[model samples]
Target: MNYVLALFLPPLSILLIGRPILSIVVFLIWVPAIIFSGGLTHPMFILLAWILIYQAHQDRRAR
Candidate 1:
């Protein structure tokens, strides 16, 4: 299903790519995906994605 795929793909891709910018982009992409998929009730998951993105950016800046 598109909803399931959308939910998983962005995070997985970010993990695979290992890039902060890409992960941030992926997290941004999830906004619309969640909206259209009617998954906004799972806001915590979105927050987790944001946390990952933030950590990635922090790591990049530290390097």
Candidate 2:
């Protein structure tokens, strides 16, 4: 679900993945990146969100 969510809302997905601080930071950068770069940088944030989501899942499994 988060993987799908990341496509459209990476920062929200990151927050859902349990990275409040990083999500705030990403939100700060993502908005401008999306605006100034004409969405060219969106995929980067999506990828970052996906990685964090995956890591969170892995951490849960480890525990």
Candidate 3:
């Protein structure tokens, strides 16, 4: 569910994964990057969010 959400809302996905600070940073960077770069940079943030989500899941599973 969050992985699928990451595909669309990267910052929100990051937040959902439990990284409030990082999510805020991503939100700040992502919106402007998308606006300025015409969405070219969005994929990078999406990938970052996905990686964060995966790591969070792994951590959860390990617990």
Candidate 4:
């Protein structure tokens, strides 16, 4: 699942760095993740993880 993680990396990077451009890049990556992993995995877990990571990034930026 390296490819799956890799897909998330760009968006994760953007989230941590607080770059809108990178965030857009992340979305691009996420699209495939959604397509490939969506039916295979638990959607709630994926969504929760994303929200948690996003919130954590935002909190870090606010600090």
- What TM-score do all the candidates reach, one by one? 0.43, 0.84, 0.82, 0.36
Top of the candidates by lDDT: 3
Q: Write the per-residue lDDT of candidate 2 for residues 1-63, one digit (tens) a residue.
A: 843443349878888988899988998888777667777987788789889988998999999
In the order shown, the candidates' Cα RMSDs to the true structure are 8.1, 4.6, 4.9, 8.7
Relative to the true structure, candidate 1 reaches a TM of 0.43
Among the numbered candidates, top TM-score falls to 2
Task: Quantify all predictions' global Cα lDDT against the true fold.
Answer: 0.67, 0.80, 0.81, 0.62
Q: Give the least accurate 10-residue stretch of model 3, judged by summed lDDT.
A: 2-11
Error in Å for residue 50 of model 2: 0.6
Ranking by TM-score: 2, 3, 1, 4
Q: Model 1, 1-52: lDDT tens per residue?
A: 9867867765665665466676666667777768787876356555666677
- After aligning candidate 4 to the native by TM-score, how far in Å is the CA of 31 from where it should be? 25
Note the residue pairs that clash in candidate 2. Answer: none
- Quick one: ranking by lDDT, best first? 3, 2, 1, 4
**Per-residue error (Å), model 4, residue 57:** 0.3
